[model samples]
Target: MQTRSLWEHTLTFFPQFLAALKEHAPRDATVAVIGASDGKFVLPLAAAGYRVIAVERDPLALHGGEVHLPGTAHAHATGLIDRLRLEDLYDRVQVVEQDFLGSEPLDRLCDAVWTSCSWHYSVNHRRPLAEFVARMQLLVRADGLFGAEFMMPVEARHHLVDHYTSPEKLSRHFTGAWNVLLTLRTAEFTERAHHGRLQDHTHRMGLLLAARTSDHPHPHGKKNA
Candidate 1:
């Protein structure tokens, strides 16, 4: 398990992301987690019966062998599964140990794609962020959604986790019928130095949930007002 600080800067508004998913995707649908570190959301989602594909490159980080990054504990979705007696649920989940950008095109297999504060690392590696995002957009089914929580950067990104995203840039990158469903920017998010050896840091970060539509949906029954 890990401290809640990473979460504080990550998916603080997970419920909203769920609401957006429920509206666009269906029950037991297959979803791919881009950074799918140790199943933070993947485990819970799987327990709920949704088929989850957790994609991670690092052996240690994904299922927790050793914490590569000193300031944080890594994903251990496997541990969570056994501890919770979720071995039966294993059939519904797949752990793909591969680099996100280099993976084969998973055209239209997933009903949705998700990640929590993990996009920055992949996007930075791609360079020219929009191009990378466009490639990622290929994975989702047309009726499906892509939901994520990104930490907005305070200054130049010194580290992968430091890379942040904003609603404006996200909106710009995603053209066509899309919705920036939720955007929350909180300030003075103080993170005390873990051991008092490092200086505490405070800055602004944004949580964004966006979904793409088929340009225009035939105005049908019950609009999710």
Candidate 2:
């Protein structure tokens, strides 16, 4: 049986990032996905022959279980592991079940790193946005790709939080040894009701793709004089 994610059809800018990775990184590059929910992006990367590091803390999303549907109903869901196993791609992935910020640094640098609207959740708001970006940056090797598509402010409350930010605002985190490749933002648009969103809603999203330059300095941004 084919498996699907709750966000199967959600709008995303990940394709642009993947294309960029293909052009810049090697065919067997190792990738680290920060919010790899049920393998939305992970599966495709693994299918394309890229080694993947899937970082997610939600048990239901990573391990599979019952999930509430639109109405008063629930259904069995296929988690990341099951989907990978079924596709014969389990050997290409490493699952890290932990809060990214709380977890220790990744063991080794990756050729590319990507995250999608992961840090905007309330639970992550406690940590500064810079911290999240810096951590992701730290995981990429020199000349590696770093991609992120994030939520832009839509509601009054969203404006109050730094997480609901535009691509321009997020770009401030990259400098010195980093080169901004592309940045995109979508105007507020309506989206069909999904799992957490029970009613039609409007949202603005942004994407930022950058590369750690070949002469990349320390992750902390200190360069040789």
TM-score of each: 0.73, 0.95
lDDT of each: 0.60, 0.90
Clashing residue pairs for model 2:
none
Candidate 1 lDDT over 51-90, as tens digits, reads 8887777664454343323365543223433422344556
Worst 10 residues of 1 by lDDT: 1-10
Cα lDDT of model 2 by residue, 154-218, tens digit: 99999999999988899899889899999999999998877778778898999999999988555
Model 1 quality (TM-score): 0.73
Q: Show where candidate 1 strays beyond 4 Å.
A: 1-11, 68-88, 156-163, 192-200, 215-225
